[model samples]
Target: MSTPYEVEHGVTAGQTGRRPQNRRVDMESFFSFLHQISTDAISSVSSETTPQTHNNRHAEATPVDTANLFRLLQDQFATLRQTSPDATNRDFLEALIQEVDRDIADLPRLHGVGQEFLDGLDRVSKKEILKGKKGEEKCPICAVKFNEDPHPLVVALPCHTSHCFDLECVAPWLQSKGTCPMCRKNFVRKKEEKKELKEDSEEEEEFDNMNGVWLATGYPQTVIAIRGVDEKGLALVRNGVEVL
Candidate 1:
């Protein structure tokens, strides 16, 4: 009678004296072949799905560095200007410049007084000041007496002198020129000073560029605003000085 192992292996006990060792070897070989096939199939699938270029993967995942991209585009424009002076090149360059100009125009202008600074200004009622016997003082902005002004709105500045102004008069002034009109004391320090203090723990004297050219480096992200960029390109004006 054939053993079960010999029967499974398709070798009868009567046929050439069934070898148990050979059956065991064949079973081991069969499993090994199956493992190899599985491994090869997995490898093929992975290879097919993988990106051809590592740079392409990185580009898709990472945000573009706009400052560098702008610089690169400018360099290309310069190169094109030097190499090709034909109408086609001229038209392309003009179109690119116009696009950049439009982008610059669209950016939000950095306000002289940020909302936090404006919010910190003390809002005092005109009636309260009159009750305190201090409403006789005149606002430096409009040269109008506080009690007599049509509007009741008033704001006290943080200067040591405690100079106050009518909210209507001072709001516009503060929006453009952040300063105490009475003392000419700066309400908001130059952005450069703030940046230097933040980075180096030291105050540095700010210098202006000769050609009215300034770069808005204080802003973290580069979006070319009207004040930040003119026909001369990317600049910031600080204290009546252009800073590049």
Candidate 2:
């Protein structure tokens, strides 16, 4: 006699039934952390030893060649009134490095926004990538043949090309990886973690049932999470297993 509203509100199932609103904040925190690490490595500024004038080094072609970039950017922001006032702040900051730029400004526009640098990067990357398109590989999941195209099923190891696996299959394995089998890359997510949490929460709720009797959530949630586990593991712990 469980009401639909009760099911919707997670009075019965806690974790799996959660909506996007309940998950957005957590997802954002995860991705923001990802963005910070990626940007830092991509945008690092470096100093190089001057071949000549070793004693009085000039910043000619250093990663953050401030003088060169500034002169170029001034022409870019010439239409803006605010750039002149805070020009000093520009000295300390260098150009933000970007990855995989794909936009190209048309030449007939008769202006320079420096988008060309990224477009050139894109072109170079495209050429280099095209040069490497000679081989064919088959997807592990769908068995589709691909030439210079990613196997939708494959997950490529960052360090090596021989380390690809079915992406869908690999993700679940990675959630519990805690470490890569080959490279010892550590990752951990017990698929059963949230189930355990839900089970614990359900047990708490059952204790609070207070009406001299309580009904089992028949959670099936936990059991489903651990379905592929060993037979002995299920023998003693089947009560919480969702029979579905």
Candidate 3:
């Protein structure tokens, strides 16, 4: 009888499974090339203008500006796609090219999750993801079956249970839009809103503390007055009256 394949929990693809050395090498090289392209693109952009200046220009950016940025990113990916021996890398580059086009579609309103949010995304193992009774699951971006890849590093968005995607496929999308591709849910913005609410609550509490204000139970009408004295041993007064 064939031995039952055993996979661990919360581990990446190549960490445990029968992943080939060539596939591992391909993965590493693909990501490294992508990183280089990103660095070059960002460096080129920085040479022309700072981030703040770029953002300001985006509001009034002409077609030429958009085209130049698009060309800069697209040309890099095209070159990578040409030199890459692996079909998977070419597929990823194709998807990324689409993302670049979409991003340039609306430069002024383009927003995405930052590196902090991306790093904080939850990674899940193949066993952790509950598959459907249907056919093989494929990545929405590259349309490649997850099972086909020997080392599929999948990430789960906080949006839903079934909202899982290949890390490589989803990273570019999240970095471009900060929303789930399947659900269109903006988890990053939701998180920021919750944080803002908590901050506002803290600010209100601090303001109350500074003013010596307290909520008294069953004494809504009770008046607890506060008076402040200056360094001169005199009441700090305002508008010709003693400040309470």
Candidate 4:
């Protein structure tokens, strides 16, 4: 008959069965060994791949324009400071906001001139534009044939040669430039004429200062003297009064 310990542990009567204390210790050691192997493998993989991944990320990174970025940051910070007065960094924020505001105020302001210039241009019909053409006239703005286009809105400029443009095309352009696209003539005729007259007066003043007093001699008389005095020192006389 088999002993109780032998039957329970599946050991022979002469062979000893493993103690419970030793069995627990062996199981702990086996688990510890497995955990250590797993840790070592993970460490090895990380050490091998980490440098290469970091190098790739560094190589692919793009450089930023720091000056522009700093300016943008300063503007945003100034705006924030304006909105929140009780926040920190009061002095620096005030200075930055003041500088931005000064720059904005220094820019030239255009008022009612743009709208008035656009309104002054003559709006003409497509039939008037193509009055003498044999169905071959094209709009200078859209580059489309007048016969083919359904819309009939066209604007004629007051240029010496009378250049016409499509209303839709020239309206937006006039708001900003206020000039004819083809001839580059100013839409505000009176303003342009005044400017030219002022420039001419300035030039005449400069010329009068450089030369002696021929102030009373008109432009026609001056031109005649210039032509007649081809080889002599011609003195201009206004009403028989000789000017040196």
Number of the predicted model whose TM-score against the real structure is largest: 3
**Which is the winner by TM-score between candidate 2 and candidate 4?**
4
Q: Cα deviation in Å at residue 70, candidate 2?
A: 59
Candidate 4: 10-residue stretch with minimal lDDT: 38-47
Better of 2 and 3 by TM-score: 3
Q: Write candidate 1's Cα lDDT for 1-244 as tens digits.
A: 3222333234433552311221111222222222232221111111133312222322311112322223333443343444443566455555554543443444422223543565567777657666654577655433445665333456888774357765534543343335564564676675456766776543222222224433465667643322443577656555555557
TM-score of each: 0.32, 0.19, 0.49, 0.31
Model 1, runs deviating above 4 Å: 1-111, 125-127, 149-151, 190-244
Cα RMSD of predicted structure 2: 26.2
True lDDT of residue 44, candidate 3: 15
Candidate 2 wrong stretches, greater than 4 Å: 1-151, 155-179, 182-189, 212-244
lDDT of 4 at 93: 49
lDDT of 3 by residue, 61-103 (tens): 3454544445454654565566555677677778767767766
TM-score of decoy 3:
0.49
The deviation in Å at residue 141 for candidate 3 is: 1.2
Q: Where's the lowest-lDDT run of ten residues in candidate 2?
A: 96-105
Overall lDDT per candidate, in order of appearance? 0.43, 0.28, 0.51, 0.40
Order candidates by lDDT, high to low: 3, 1, 4, 2
Clashing residue pairs in candidate 2 are 178-186, 178-187, 179-185, 180-185, 220-242
Give one digit per residue, the lDDT tens place, for model 4 in 112-226.
1233454456766657545646225544534444445333455567774346654434443343234565565665566878989999999987655544433434566543122
